[model samples]
Target chain A: MKKINYNRELCDFCGTCVSVCPQDAIELSENNLEITDKCTVCMNCVYICPLRALEVKNEG
Target chain B: MKDRYDVIVVGGGPSGSMAAMFAARAGVSVLMLEKDREIGLPVRCAEGVGDKGLRSVVDINPNWIAQKITTVKLISPAGMEVVIGTDEVGYILNRKMFDPGLAELAAQAGSEIITKAYVNGLLLDNNKVTGVRVRTLGREFQVKASIVIGADGVESRVGRWAGIKTWEKLNDMETCAQVTAQNINVQQDAIHLYFSNTRAPKGYLWVFPKGNGLANVGIGISGEASRHKSPFAYLFEFLQTNFPQAAIITTVAGGVPCAREPEKIVANGLMLVGDAARQVNPVSGGGIVTGMIAGKIAGQVAGQAIIDGKTDEKRLAEYARLWQKAEGKKHKVFYKLKEFVYNMSDKDLDDTAKIALQIPQDKRTILQLFKTALVQKPALILEAIKVLT
Candidate 1:
């Protein structure tokens, strides 16, 4: 299973991934992006990035 | 023998009806199931749609229209209004009649419509959808079909049951409450949008006139800050101040998904359309056009598959491919854009409004406006600027 590896370092603090995630899996804490347990790998943020910052990691 | 049809469309909304209509015209037997006893009763919409989006399919019928609009007025958070001059090219549809009328058109095209039929589950065979189990009129029955389309709106359970990942985050969803009130003093020719933070924190409020002193007054706020208070509470506050003299006629409350793209609407042997697919506009919370377009494509693919006798996941991947080919890139881009725009601070919005107000009325191209408001990569902004313009 591939998991999303959110690069907090590169994130623009725009919350695009947070709003586009259908599962409400992403939250913003003090301008830092937090990936929650509810994530279902929708990839809405991965695809919706204007900055191309968020990445995904698949687990074997 | 178990019964079977070419396509089983769940939800008799416009998209489902259009799907059934197109598939039936392609010579496939179609069955449309609507949970509501009345197909278009208790209307739930701002009732406005762009003219270009409607012209692609059916001509705008006069009977279905409440008003034909020609101008739009956008107000900023600071109460500064900018009236744009575009070809007045939209209609406030009388959904009560228009919705049922579209279903009737589907029936005329040889599709069978079953109202009051609530689909409770999807019948799966060998990990693939084969039919649906529905309860209606105090009885339960099952119907088999080659293709199943989930056209049920915003909070669709069918997509979830089929493992399509239909969840919407609280912050991404816009809780909406609207009402059509009579005896109001509002501009009948132009739509009014209020963008003040005091009115809506994460979203905006709108007043769409339906002619003859009637208008649909509504507001939507992002679900993130709206956890404690209901959408009705927010809308009531606005109504009390703005339209205090207006008589209340009807009220509607629902959630609108503002996500740029849905998780996945297409899977092996199944597809979703309309609000179920989250095909709505990211900014406006409008889905009528996008849903209709998706339905047309899904209908075409389903028809061709039935003719070829290949309704499996591999074969149905074409629909997914075609959808992405048609609007996937735009959806991806819009998702990012929506996030950036929604995150704009009140000060940012105020400054942007100042810039917009400075531009001469004729010089307001969407590109110039977005660029002036945003300080992001030109490529993404340019792409979005071109698409919206």
Candidate 2:
């Protein structure tokens, strides 16, 4: 399984992750951005984050 | 908060702000919403705008300009360089200040401006967009409007929510990454563009000088190439090789729609502008000017629609007609040029660079380069002349 980790402090909520996500897994609320379970570890959000707030880890 | 407005513009970038300003200037009640708490934080663009385009839309404000550009250098894959002098000059903007400044202009023009107001979806009445449902500061609200303008950018949900078919193919999306770095050596008055398949892969890299050893260095890669490697990785490598000692000040990454405007941009009671409408220049990947132009048109038409009490697709079609006449025709040609240039092999690019170098440095112009690049398509010569001259 692949899991995603988010650093809330680093996130500026620019919503680039939500924009690039192929799985429609990210959403931005007023203060925080949520990555849903549908995130397929595609790593698009991880690479696109200007603040480097997202990380994807492979858990075997 | 007022639940109704004559015009509701979603997004506070140049397009949204301009739309709000023009709409409000016409005595219409306008409200502009920005998703971010700050207008232009986490800036995603290289921030370069041509002088003519900027002057056409807004007054030249010294506070908004970071550097004045007088020249552009095109470097080929094989390291050949062709430098072209700009006729009207350009500017690398301080977007952090520029975006807010435009928002302030909108506010001053009698438009209500709100930050941290993230538009979540569209409010539709009988398959026509009538308003937007926005979430702000942990509270959600629905604001009704006679007209809705979606200037929300490339990942525009407002357009999608309205069923406008805003989907873009992978090839049309350019994944981009940029950093403002200090202590980098750059020509103070020139923007350097590097074209190479190995470096950018179906797109190009840019070093836009922001004066005094500061520059916005960035790379844009086609979505097809981005699927194989991250744009950030390429940018990192480029920086390590070029400006190893430079300190990174700010980093940004996003996608630019390098495609023609969507076939349909206006729906009943709603319209799309800027990146939401995919109005970016296909070759340069710049949208600020075009967005503002579209914003002005949309705003004017929107205000007129409100005045006439008719906000249907037919009335708003004036915006589409006007924008297509203004720059849409040129953009269509640029799209074809982008497809042609991006598809060129490294050898072809190298050959083109060699040809460009043959022109006298003093005589070298952007139009001449375009002429060389489009030599195979002799049919486009007249169109190139129309664009350049």
Among residues 3 or more apart in sequence or in different chains, the pairs in candidate 1 whose N, CA or C atoms overlap within 3 Å are A1-A59, A2-A58, A2-A59, A3-A57, B70-B88, B268-B313
lDDT tens readout by residue for model 1, B194-305? 7755567677889899999999998877776564454567677888877888788887655677775656776656888887888877777788877887887888888889
Can you list each candidate's DockQ? 0.05, 0.24
DockQ, prediction 2 = 0.24
Please list the residue runs of candidate 2 whose C-alpha ends up more than 4 Å from where it truly belongs after superposition. A1-26, A29-31, A34-60, B374-389
The lDDT for every candidate, in the order shown, is 0.75, 0.85
lDDT of 2 by residue, B1-389 (tens): 59999999999999999999999999999999988878876587899999998889989789999999988899988888788755778999999999999999999999998888988888999988889999887899999999999998877767767776765666777878888999978788899999988889989999999999999999988776776577888999989987899899988767888976777899999999998898999999999999999999899999988999999899899999999999999898888778767766677678778888888877788667777876744655665564555
> Using DockQ as the measure, which candidate wins?
2
TM-score for chain B of each model, two decimals: 0.93, 0.95
- Chain A vs. true chain A, TM-score per model, equals 0.84, 0.87
Give the DockQ of candidate 1. Answer: 0.05
Q: Is the docking of candidate 2 incorrect, acceptable, medium or high quality?
A: acceptable
